[model samples]
Target chain A: MTYCVAMNLAEGLVFVSDSRTNAGVDNIATFRKLHIFGTPGERLVVLQTAGNLATSQSVISLLRQRLDGEEANLHNVDSLFEAARLVGSTLQEVVEHDCGNVQRQGVDLGCSVLLGGQIGEEQPRLFNIYPQGNFIEATRDTPYFQIGESKYGKPILDRALNHATPLEQALRCALISFDSTIRSNLSVGMPLDLLVYHAGSLEVPQGFRVKEGDAYFEGIRAQWCSGLRQLLGELPAPPGDYWS
Target chain B: MTYCVAMNLAEGLVFVSDSRTNAGVDNIATFRKLHIFGTPGERLVVLQTAGNLATSQSVISLLRQRLDGEEANLHNVDSLFEAARLVGSTLQEVVEHDCGNVQRQGVDLGCSVLLGGQIGEEQPRLFNIYPQGNFIEATRDTPYFQIGESKYGKPILDRALNHATPLEQALRCALISFDSTIRSNLSVGMPLDLLVYHAGSLEVPQGFRVKEGDAYFEGIRAQWCSGLRQLLGELPAPPGDYWS
Candidate 1:
């Protein structure tokens, strides 16, 4: 289980991913789901993965192995769309290779990927790559993509996010969304990987790792909890007419 | 699809169910999922259903049919636990009767039920009856149960609800949870049915129907959204050190 979200806003893009993977309740491990690729001053691509650990790791490993090769890879892709296609195809390849044996044992080998980045003069773009090698790009009306354990955290994004939102504000919403998910689900745990990119900036964005006890994260969690309680208290109860 | 939730708290029980029922996106209708049973002043039982509309309706119809018969029924049940067992077994019977034909057409015949109320001298109790004809009672540690499209509304309840939560506060939380679910899911919608039971009050509890233009509902929706935005802005964003 995993929870990864990325937002494409007017100013830039923001990405957040949890680091927990579990075979079951008893067998759990932490793995970085966010991977950074592309040249420092040319193309910057970020990939966040969820689903079968083996399939995602294989897809990432294949992408990395091909980065220095002559093949069309994240580094050499002409645009964000092409990078998304490359990632989707890699995901499909890994799933196809392992699904037969895995499914025989009643295990799922499917993986979902989020590919977001900027290329040269193009604006930052975000794509949700399905397990079947197909993808959809984020647009002005729908500015965010979430995969894996998405519903628990989706109401906030649906209510607050839009293309006009500032990059910093979008980042805050992403963290709050993650907070809701982590509190409701045990499978999605910390530390978290966060990345923010300025639109049209062709530099590899700096990625931040937020671990347990991070002051900002803890503060947001506590404040949000108390704020919600207070807000609920302030809301008027049902009218007395309804209490008959 | 449907969304129904019930909470067992110290003050009493709270049940909230959305009225939307859909066979597909284009085939949607409004049908009450919350049902009240029991003899007034003796026992008060509320049943909330989710899943295949045909199956849930059949279960309810069967229970109603047997109310005046020699067979054990909700009105005749000695305890809330017995009422839950009756609901669970009725659900299983309906599914078993229809599953073969339904599955042949690739349709589901399963339904999940939430049974909560007071009977005789027992305290208010809540039960989540699965499609398999088995049920689990809510305890002090876990005081709520949600069925169908539940995840979108679950984070708030997970954070704010406990056995000791005041009945009015619990009712507020339940409404907010439904609001979140309705915003994020098209399958769950307006005209919610809300019922609150006070412990030791054997009389039938009044049920509130909250429609689209209800003033209090609209106010809560507006206030919760803006309050969340204000809280997000007040929380300090990630430290400058992480933004490199």
Candidate 2:
């Protein structure tokens, strides 16, 4: 299990992902799910993955593996859409290669990715790529995509995120969403990888690698807890014989 | 799908349930999930059901029919635990009678209940009854149980609830939990039935019916949204280039 989220806002794109993976409670380990690809000013795309670790990592490696000589790649993709296509193609290839063996062992090749960033003159964009290698781009009406352990955290995003939100504000929303996921699920843990890309900046974006004890995340956790209690305290109790 | 939560708190107990029932998105209807028995000072036992509506309704009907007999029934149970046993026994009876027919169509029997209340000198108690008729009492550590569409609302309870929490405060927590569930899931909707019981108080517990226009709920919803944003605003942003 994992929790990864990416948002495309007016100011930029925001990506947040947790770094915990477990086969069983005793087999827990840290694995960064966010993969970054860039050529500085030319392009900057990030892929946040969830589902079967082997499949996701295989897809990522296939996406980055050199294809002989000069050929289309995330590094040289002309548009964000093309970059998404490259990811989709890679996912399909990886699934085709691995699904047969996985099926023999009674495992399903389940994997998905949140792909987002900018390339050349194209506007910042985001997409959710499914296991079948098909994808859906984020639209103005729905400006974010989340993969894995999504339900626990979805309410915060449903209420808070929009296409016009500022970069920092979107970051805040993503963290709250992550906070919700972490509390309800053991599969999503600390050492978060977050990226905030300013639209059109093109160059490598600013972000954080948030480990446990990271001051900012600790503050967010404590404040959210306190704020929820405070807000709940302010709500009016039911009137006379309300439950009678 | 449904969302029903019951809490065993220091003050007593609280149970809230959404009434919407859906076989699919196109097939949805209103059906009350809370069942109340007895009057003030006699004994008050409330049952909140979630999961397969037919199975739950069957259990309810069975319990009701038992009440029509001259001997034992929910109203005549000597204690809250005995009332829970009656509910569980009734559920098993319904399953025995209907499960074979239901499973023939490839649908498994599924239903659960949050049974809570006071009877005579026995302190107020709450139990989460499973589909198999087995159940577990809420403890001081956890103190609450939610069934169906639970993940979206679980974090609120994880962060806000405890056995030491006052009944009013716990009620607010339950509402916040319900609010989150309603926001994320179409299957869980209003109007909500909220019941609160005071510890050792052998009186008819208070009940609050929250319709769409319910002012307190509206205020809580708005305040929670704003409070979450405010809390997020207060957290420090992650450091630049930490992900590089």
Candidate 2 residues B27-86, lDDT tens each?
999999998886678688889998888889998887887886876788887977787778
Give the per-residue lDDT of model 1 (tens digit) for A148-186: 999999999998889998888888889999999999999
**How big is the positional error of residue A11 in model 1, measured in Å on the Cα after superposition?**
1.3
Off by over 4 Å in 1: none
User: Where is the poorest 10-residue window by lDDT in model 2 chain B?
Assistant: B235-244
Best by TM-score: 1
Q: Clashing residue pairs, candidate 2?
A: A242-B207, A242-B208, A243-B206, A243-B207, A243-B208, A244-B206, A244-B207
**Count: clashes, candidate 1:** 0
RMSD of each: 1.3, 2.1
> Model 2's CAPRI class?
medium
DockQ in order: 0.72, 0.61
Candidate 1, residues B88-118, lDDT tens digits: the string is 8898888888877768898878889999999
Model 2 regions lying over 4 Å from their true place: A67-71, A241-243, B70-72, B241-244
| Alpha-carbon lDDT of model 1 | 0.90
Candidate 2 per-residue lDDT, tens place, A72-158, comes to: 887877888888888888888888888777678888778898999888888888999988878999988999998988999998898
